[model samples]
Structures are given as structure tokens and as C-alpha cells.
Target: MWNEILHRSWLRLEQNYHFNDSQNVLNVLKQAYAESQRAYHTLQHISECLFHFEQVQDLLGDARAVELALWFHDAVYNPKASDNEECSATLFQDLLKDDLSTALLAKISQWIIATKQHLPSSDQDLNLLLDIDLAILGATSKRFIEYQQQIQCEYHWVDSEIYQHKHKQVLTHFFLQQPLYQTTFFQDHFELQAKQNLTLALAGNLK
Candidate 1:
């Protein structure tokens, strides 16, 4: 499935530039996602984001850039690192600099950076990408619980009490956001469920 998604993304890009190292780049990305320490920021997360993007593909101004951003968003994840998004965006530019236009590179960089805050953006594509990156918050109860646990595993080095305290603060910030998802599709389908899940999780019910 990962291969198929990578292939599809490559097909979209191949129209503009011929990359002789496409397979090599795909392998590196696959390895990054499959890293042993990854729990929530794994290939599965990428697949889920891609799946959500398909639901709102028609609403995007640059679907190809959004798709590429999804593939590289978590490409440099590190539980202890705060600059993963910056590094991932840099990697995207380095690898595809010869292939993509300056404007497209800028768009992809903006999309990746926006995932860091998951804030609303004036650009529709960035808003949709942010919504998709956070769709897990509105997942079914079972899946949402699994996601919480996976994230805990990713931060296993931290003490449980410390983790919970920090996690609550993060979730509370999301609660403070008037609308968790900016896109109408995500807002309509996930906004209520996300608030419910956040409430439950923050209350220590789903920990």
C-alpha cells in the first residue's frame, strides 16, 4: 500500500520532471516512516492522511503539492526533536529542487510548516492539509484510544505523570480553537466527534 501511494505521487510529479532516483527516494522515505521508534508518526499515519486528502481533493487548489507534502510531513520525525517539520521541509526542497518549480516548493514548504501548529491558513490547500493531518482526533473511539497509546509509546522516555500533564495542555489548546478543522468537509464530519474525543481524553477517561 505504501509503495502504491508513493508510485501514485511520483506519477503526478513525473509529468513535470523525470526523476531517475525516484525509487531510491521512495526507499529512503519508507525507511524513515518505518523507523523503530515511530509509533503514531509512522507509515500508517501517512496513509491515513492521504486517505483523508482524497475526500477533499476537489477542494484543493494544488492537489499535487498537498499530496507531496503529506508524504514528507513526518518524514523527519523525532520524538526528542522540535525541528522535524523544518528538517522535513528542507529535505523535500533538497530532493526535489531540480524537479519542482520555485512556487510549488514554496507551497509545499508552507503546507508542511502549517502542520506544526495545525492552525487555519488563508490558503485553502494548507487548510485542507492541516485538517487531514489532524483527522485522527475524530477517529472512532477505539482508534482514538489506540492513537493516544501510540503517542504515549513514542514519548516513552517521559514519566507517565509528566506526559499526561503535557498532553492535557496540548489537547486543551485544541479545545480553545473555535473550530478544530477549518475545511467544511472536516468540520462537518469531524468537528463534533473531535471535541467529544478531546473532552473524554482530557478528562482521563481514555488514557
Candidate 2:
């Protein structure tokens, strides 16, 4: 099963990201994963997102484009910097020059930035990409706690007050939302549990 999935993913990437340089591609993936504070939200994160994406592949018009976006979405994550999305998008543009079409790169870049704001445009592929990126918001209790710890490790440099404030704002932002998961699949799988977890996390800090 795993091999079949891996083969399919490889085929997908080959058809989607036609980078001729294999070594460079591997290096990009390694660097992106290593730089991410949360393994669960980095390469592992993208992999999980891809898995879920594959399950609901038909829902997207350009599933391949979203997959490409996923590979490069978190490529330039810097905990302290707010321009990580822009940087990642730019990197994709530069790296894929001549390999990917100008229009396709623009779409991929837009999808990367969309992850910053959970509100993807009405475009189904972009919406699916953002939903997969935030899949953890609706994880189970044990998984959610693990995710919290991973995120904490990502910002070890920040002071407690700042981290708490920012984290609270993020949790509160989602909790205040009408629907935590914008995508139907995510709504079905994780919306309620994620709300419960966020509410608990916010309450825990108050204590």
C-alpha cells in the first residue's frame, strides 16, 4: 500500500514538477524539512496533506498544481519573519524557471500565500491546499497535544508573553470563525475536535 502510494506520488510529481535535476530536488526537500520547527507541519506535514489530498483528489480541478504548491509552500519558513510565504513563493519561481510555466508558477505562489490566511479563494484547488495545510487544527486530543509541542519548539527563541499572545490570537481567530475547516473533507474529519482542542488550550493558558 505504502509503495503504491509512494509510486503514485512520484508519478504525480514527475508529471507536475518536471525538474530535471534530481539531486537539487532532494536537497530542496531536505532543506525545507530541516528548517521547519515542526516536523509534523513541515515535510511530514506536506506528506500527510498529500495523503489526504490523494484521497479527495477528484474534488480539485488542478490537483497537480496544488501538490506542487504543497511541496514549496513551507520551503522558506522563518519563525521570526512574517514574509516566509513570499520568500517561499519567490524561491519556487526562481527554481522552477524554464521548467514550469509562468502562469502555473503564479498559481502555485498564490496557493502558498493563501495558507497564511485560511481563506482560500473560491478556486477548489487552492482551497484544498490550504485545508490540507491546516489539517492539524482538527486533530485528535493526543495528536493535537503533540502538534502544540511541535509548534512550541518552532518558536523557542520567542519570549513567553509574545508567543502566548500570538498563539492565543491564532487559536482565538479560528475559534471565532463560523467554520474552522473551510473545506468539506476537513469539516467532516476535524472541525469539531479542533474547536474543542483550541478552546481547551486557550483555557489552560488562563489558569
Candidate 3:
């Protein structure tokens, strides 16, 4: 998966660079995603994001950049930490710096950073990437419930009450997004169902 996606981005960038170290980087990323503490933000989540990326590839300003950012977005997730995006972005640039221009590096890093909030954005690539990262919010009811459960498991160390209250705040944040889905494609396909999901979750319907 990384091979094909990385290769595509490399070709499109047309850099005088080499990733014969590709396998090494992939191994480390696999290890990161396979950590025992993760209930979500695992390789499966990346695969899911990729699935959404495929859906709106044509609508992106830079498909390769979007895909590249997706691959590294949650690459360093730590449910207990606020700096996961920073760490992930740094890891991305550190590993691929030789192959990417400074502008592209900033673009990718900024995309990963933007996911920290999933806030509305003006950049087309950023908007689509944000939409793809958040597509889970508008997934089928079963999957949405599963996602909630997965999130809970990831934070199992927190007290139930604290977790519940904090979790509610997070859900409310997304719920308050005047328009949760940014792009027209996502807005059309996910806006209604996502609103329903957030409303129900906030109303304590998930259990």
C-alpha cells in the first residue's frame, strides 16, 4: 500500500530522490500503527481514509499531496497527547525531506496539523483531506457506533465520568461546526447523516 502510494507521489513530484529506504520507513510506520495501546488510529484507519481519498481524487488540487498527507496524518497518534500532529508532521518531513520541496513539505505538514481540529479551510486540497479524515463521522450507523466504541477503548485509562464529559465536549465541537462537511461532495453525501450521528451521540444515544 505504501509502496504504490509513495511511488505515485514520488513520480509526480519528479524529484531527483531515492527511497530505496522505502521498506525501512514502511516497517517503522507499520510498527507505529501496530502498537498495542491503539484501538483506533491504526492501519485500518489509514486504509479507510485511503478509501475516501479514492472517492474524491478528481476534486483535489493535488491528489498526490493529499494522499501523502493522508498516509502520514495519524501516523504518530497518541490518544493521551496533544502533540501527535506535530510529531507526525515532523516524522513525515524528516523521512522525506530529501525528496520533497520546502513548499510541499509545508503543505503536507499543514494538512496534518489541520486535522487536529478538522476545521473548515479555504485550500481545496486541505478541504478534501479534512473531509476524507472525517468521513468516519458520516459513516453508516453501525460503523459510527463502532467508531465511538473504538475511541472509548483508546481512552480506557481515563475515568468514566471524565472521559464521558470530555468526549461529549469533543462531539459537541464537531456538532457545532456550522457545516461539518467542507466539500460539496462530502456535504452532499455526509452532511445529513453526520448531523444525525452527532446529534444522537450528544443526546447519549450511543451507549
Candidate 4:
């Protein structure tokens, strides 16, 4: 399934510029997603984002750019690293600079960086990208619990108390945000459940 997505995404890029080493690039991306340290930020996460993107593709200004951004958003994830988004965006540009226009590459880089704050932006495509990246927050109870566990595994080096403290702060920030999701699609489907999930998790009720 992931391979098929990669193939289709590569084909989309091919439309703009011809690249001969797509297979090698795809392999590198696959390896990044398959890294042993990843639990939540794995290929499955990319697939989830793709699934969400398809649901709202018509709303995007540049569907192809948004799709490509999803592929590289977490390409350089490191739980302990503060510059993962920067690094990932750099990698995205490095890999596709030859195949994409400078303007489109900059747009994609902006979309990837927006994931760091998950805040609404003036750009509709960016709003949708952020929404898709965070859709997991509104998943079913079982899946939400699984996501929490996976996150813990990714940050296993942190002491339990410290982790909880930091986690609570993060959840609180989301709760304080006027609307967690910017897109109407996500706002309608996930707004309430997302609040519930975050509240439960922050209150130590989701464990």
C-alpha cells in the first residue's frame, strides 16, 4: 500500500520534472519511515495522512504539493531532536529541488514546518495539511490509547514523571487553542472527540 502511494506521488512529481533516480529516493524514504526508533511516526502515520488527504483533496490549492509534504513531514523524526521539521524540510528540498519549481518547493517546506505548531494558517492547503497530520488525536479510544503508548515508546528515554509533566503541557496548549482543527472537514468530524481524548489523556484517565 505504501509502495503504491509512493509510486503515485512520484508520478505526480514526474509530471513537473523528469527524474531518473526515483526508485532510489523511494527506497530512502521507505527506510526513514521504517526506522527502528519510530513507533507513531512510521509508515502507518504517512498512510493515515494520505487517507485523510484524499478525503479533502478537492479543497486544496495544490493537492500534489500537499501530498508530497505529507511524505516528508516526518521523514527525519527524532523524539529528542528539536529540529526534526527543519531537517525533514531540508531533506525534502534536497531530494526534489531538481524536480520541482523553487516556488513549489518553498510552499512544501512551509507546509512541513507548520506541523510543528499545528496551528491554523492563512493558506487553506496548509490548514488542511495540519489537520491531516493531527487526525490521529481524534481516533477511537483503542487507537488513541495505542497512539499514546507508541509515543511513550518513542520517548522511552525520558523519566516517567518528567514525561507526564511535559505531555500535560502539550495537551494543555492544544486545549487552549480556540479550535484544534482548522478545516471544516476535521472540525466537524474530530473536534469533539479530539477534545475528549486530550482531556482524558491529560487527566490520567486514558491510560
Candidate 5:
């Protein structure tokens, strides 16, 4: 179902440049998400993001482009690597440069790369996309704990103490975000629960 929707988006992205078989492209994406090295950055994450996208998509100026960016934002994932976002953006650029307008491609790439820090953006589309990506932060208690475990599994190679410290720092940083989610929808729906979840994690109670 998700594949079909994403494929349709790809096929109709733009008629300026001829594109190749979109199924093959989607197959590559499935393979990437299914990589053994991943625990959280998987199809499940993408599906969750897509679910969130469907909710507020009507608010976006270029919803399809935002959806495309969401589809490719995590195309490259390495728990130990810092350039995952850049690499993901590059992958999107390489695959669609022939199809999408250069300006649209650039904006999509920027949207994908923006997930790195998940920082606030002046662009409403970007703000919505980022909020969707981080929606797990404000998921229900069971899902939030699962997300923590999934993240831990991804970085399981790291020493326990080091991972613990760094993980705490990561949680704290997010906790300190003046408004964790940039969009009103997410802020209205998830902000309170997200802050509670973050508070618990920072206090070492969520594990």
C-alpha cells in the first residue's frame, strides 16, 4: 500500500525528464530499509512518517514533494556515521535529477538534509516534515519505549556506558527544544506527551 502510493508519486513527479521504472527504485528503497544493520530506521519508520504525513498533508504547499522527501529522507542510514542525511540527500538527487526541476530537487534535498538536526525552519513545509519524522518522540508510551529500544539496538556496538551517556545527552537536547515540534498540529496533539516522555527518559525512568 505504501509502496503503491510512493510509486505513483514518483511516476508523476514531473514530465520534464524521463524517469526509469519506479518499482525498481522502490525495490532498492525496500532493500535499504531492510538492511540488517538497521533497527529503527526501517520501513516501519517510513510508514509511521507517511501516516503522519497523511494527517496534515493538506496543509503543505507542495505536499507531494514533501512526501517524496519523506520517502527518501532516510534512504541512507548508518547508526555510527554522521553523514547519513547528506548521503540520503545525495541518493535522492542522483535518482531524480533527470526528472524533477533543479529547484524542486534542491529544496527536496534540503528537506531531507534538514532531518539531521531536526531544527526549526522558517519554511512551513519543512517544519511539518520534520515534525513527522520525529513523531515517534511523542508516540504512545509503549511505542516511545519501543523507539528507545530500537535506537539502542541500532547502536548496540557501542559500549554500554558510552551509549548511555550519549543517549542521555541526545534526549536532553531534544527535551530542551523550546517547542519540540515546530507545527501547530503536532504541538497541539503530541507536545505534552512528548515532553512527559522526554522528562521520564532524562530522569532514567523510561528504560
Candidate 6:
């Protein structure tokens, strides 16, 4: 199933991107997914985001940059590293070389960095990619809890106190945002549930 999705995605990339070799793209995907800690940042994440983007196709008219950005967002996901986004963005630019426009490449790089900063933004594609990345926050109660557990597991190396503090800050930041979801779909589905989860997590950490 996973390979099927990867193959289909690679096919789409071949059609859309300037790449000629299928094996090279496949190798990059394999390496990145292998290095990711959880299925959250794995090939599954890329496939799922592609599905979400397709679902919101109307919202993403001429959104090739966002699609490319998603492909590399988690490519260099190193929990212990603060510059993963920068590294991933640079790596992608190098890989694309002169195939894509410099302006478009910069936009894609900006979108990837936005995933890490998550600041208020007017960029529709960037917002949509972020919403998809965090769509699980608005998942059903059981799934939401499962996501929390997975995130905690991803930070297993950290002591409980440090983890709790860092986690609390993140939850608090999200809760304090003007709109948890900048997109209509996310607002309709995830805003309330995300706030509830963040509130509970913060309270639990405090206790």
C-alpha cells in the first residue's frame, strides 16, 4: 500500500517536475522516510498531505509550489536539530537546480520554513499545508489522543520535566493563536477540538 502511494506520487512528480530519473526520486523518498522517527513524518505523512491537497483542490489553484514544499517539509526532520527546515529547504533547492524558477523555489523554501515558525501569514498555500500537517489535531477524540501519544513517544529521549515544559509552550502558543486554523476546512473541523486538546494538555502539564 505504501509503495503504491509512493509510486503514484513519483509518477505525478515526473509529470510535473523537471526530474527525469524515477530511481533518484525514489531513493530520496526512501532515505528521508527511513530517517523519520514516526509514521507521522514518514512517507505516510507525504501521501496523506497529498490526499488532503487533492481534496481541497479548489483552494489550491496553481499550487505546485505548495505540493513541492510538502515533499521536502519533513525530508530533514531531526528532532534534536533546530535548523532542520533550513537544511531541508536548502537541500531541495540544490536538488531542483535550475529546473524550477528561482522565485518559485524561494516560495517553496519559505513555505517549508513556515511549517516550523507557524506565524500568522497571508500565504494561502502555506496556510493550507500547515493545516494539513496539523489536521490530526482536529481528529476524532480517540485519534487525537493517539496523536498525542505518538508525539510524546517521538520525544522519548527528553526527561519528563523538559518535555512537559517544551510541550506546554507549544500547546500554549497554539491555543493563543488568533485562529487555530487559517483555512475554512480546518476551522470547521479542527479549531475547537485543537483548543480543547491544547487546554487539557496545558492543564495536565501544570498539574
Q: Judge candidate 1 at residue 143 and give its lDDT.
A: 89
What is the alpha-carbon lDDT of model 6 when measured against the actual structure?
A: 0.76
Candidate 2 C-alpha lDDT tens digits along 31-73: 7777646545476676677777787788989878887787788
RMSD of 6: 2.7
* C-alpha RMSD of each candidate structure in angstroms: 1.7, 2.6, 3.0, 1.8, 2.4, 2.7
Ordered by TM-score, highest first, the candidates read: 1, 4, 5, 3, 2, 6
Where does model 4 exceed 4 Å of error? Answer: 1-18
The TM-scores, one per candidate, come to 0.93, 0.89, 0.90, 0.93, 0.92, 0.87
Q: Each candidate: what lDDT?
A: 0.86, 0.77, 0.84, 0.86, 0.87, 0.76
Q: For residues 154-190, write the lDDT of model 4, one tens digit per residue.
A: 9999999999888888889987777988989999998
Worst 10 residues of 2 by lDDT: 1-10
Clashes of 3: 0
Whole-model alpha-carbon lDDT for candidate 4:
0.86
Q: What local lDDT does model 2 show for residue 146?
A: 80
Best by lDDT: 5
Question: Where does candidate 3 stray beyond 4 Å?
Answer: 1-18
Query: Residue by residue across 58-89, what tens digits does model 1's lDDT show?
Result: 88888877888998999999999999999999
Give a tens-digit lDDT track for model 6, residues 1-207: 656655666676678875755567568867887774764577767877776766775788556667777788878877778998898888888777667888878888888888888765787777888898777666666766766776787788999999978887887888888688889988986789888777776777412
State the lDDT of candidate 3 residue by residue for 116-139, as single tens digits: 978777788899999988999999
